[model samples]
Target: MTMSEPLDPNVARAAKLDTATLSDALDKLGIAGQCYRIKPRDVNFRMTGRAWTLLYGPAGKPCGTVGDYIDDVPPGSIVVLDNGGRDNATVWGDILTEIAHRRGIAGTLIDGVCRDTALCRQLGYPIFSKDHWMRTGKDRVQVEATGVPVNIGDARVAPGDIVRGDADGVLVIPKEHESAVLDTAEAIEVAEEAIRNAVRGGMRLDEARKQFKYHQLQTRQEG
Candidate 1:
């Protein structure tokens, strides 16, 4: 099945690469402006997660949870939280992490603050947050619309967007581009490995670079 169609959780989890591989893939692909992840990091785990975004309002009728929209949400759903761009209230907490872990969830993303930060880290669940705090959001805010388009920092996420997060922040891979990104990422990884090996074998940087034409190769449109 294509990425635009429903993806198997089993397949997604299998597609998850280690942090080293992911970083190397990013480096090869020349994707930048990401890193400096949240504190008390766990570098061991990697997540292959999908977005279930939500907008929010205070005690309103149109609210839900990381679990509500994703209760039966596939095991790899990332639960990307977008509380109307507010970074003050808690959108993720210990219980949420516990729930996610139980359900085989890949991870969580808060484009805002999260409470029980220590618990999340303790469980070794990957959560990308804009900030951390102890404030409760149950009274102040609740989800307004679930599985809708929401903005996380500069990235716009829909229900099925692949949200990959590790010790190096999150990369929003649109559902439309999942196959392209994944395939290109692997290709980049292959080229990067070749370059690294050449560099170690007494080949100078400039000569190897000119010989490989890596820059031109990655930029060329693939049919």
Candidate 2:
């Protein structure tokens, strides 16, 4: 699909697929989309949307503001922050969480930390990050760039990439491969479900898996 094409339909389809399935799909495609070391604040919280990336770096002679870009983020867009995986300082807080939730933003994913867990939990705003700390990133770090490629938990995220997060953590799907990944994930889900059904119908677990070729579901396919 072209860059100008609407991604909402693919994003919607991806929203139904869990991180596990997506991860498997990525593996089958030999893609590194899994964001390791990043996890949701609350296990029950889940979110999916196109990424709006922000990169953070050490502050220069002058410091920069934190979370001033929230207002610019469109509804249903996921705010992805690349904070260099710094757990000592936080780039997100109660104010940002409150605004994002009120604005109907999908969620926030950070490579570093976020503060104000209480507000995010109360608002049911999903945040996947390395961890949470009370220290502010105001003077420690500054916004280096926005809408540029950034690394989050070892995963490279680009503007408009499909981001999915859940209790299992977060995964980034490259926009160019979104369609293929979603199609593969859906097919895997269907096969697994069939295996489950077969087992429930008195088939042995091993037999059901063999019948469904479960072992080959996630095996990398040669182009």
Candidate 3:
């Protein structure tokens, strides 16, 4: 990568905003992007990248491997693993964490759980999941497909969708809605900042909010 190549505009824009602001933007547009229950391994962790989705399911008589797909994920992409929110098995672990950190991968978001929490934290690699456990998914769950649409919490994340995560949690912005969502999120951020500035300058909280239209920022609009 050189000056000849430009950063992805959506990715760049999403990086400036947190998941909370983005969530509000999603609501204002009536788009479902908030992922419920999923949380970051560390509150300080943050990541923004396009999603490279993997769907997992209960293994058959002969189980499949859990990590081969990590090699195929492009650098700067978020690996989204959907295991049907199964806590009994772990689809991610130490090996994958080390490899992803070395490969320049943005991070990993699992709809289920991950293992090797110490390794991930030590490596400073971002991982957002329902929980972490030592159990492995090796003989329990198998990859149903790669580069496919998957569910993360209550949100639907398609391959190539913008996946951003922070201390609050993770959220997916569909590729088709990325532009609008980013625009709306930026506006909401601006309005909120204005409200804060007003308060700092001596305006009442309610007055500042009203002046900036803060209350209506996340309200859905009519078509």
Report the number of the highest-lDDT candidate.
2
The estimated TM-scores of all candidates read 0.76, 0.95, 0.96
Of 2 and 3, the candidate ahead on lDDT is 2
Tell me, what's the RMSD of every candidate? 5.2, 3.5, 2.1
What TM-score does candidate 3 get on C-alpha atoms? 0.96
Q: Worst 10-residue stretch by lDDT in candidate 1?
A: 32-41
lDDT tens digits, residues 22-136, model 1?
A: 4444444554413234322355545665677777766655543433454655665777777655666887778777888777777777767787867767787777777777887
Output candidate 2 Cα RMSD: 3.5
Best-matching candidate per TM-score:
3
Compute the lDDT for candidate 2.
0.91
lDDT of 3 by residue, 1-223 (tens): 6211114988989989999999999999999988899999988889888999999988988777665877788888999999999999998888899999998888999999999999888988999999998888888988888988999998999999999999999999999989999999999999999999999999999999988998899999777
Q: Candidate 1 or 3, higher lDDT?
A: 3
Q: Candidate 3, clashing residue pairs?
A: none
How high is the lDDT of residue 202 in model 2? 99
Q: Model 1 compared with the native: what TM-score?
A: 0.76
The lDDT of model 1 is 0.64
Error of 2 at 27 (Å): 0.5
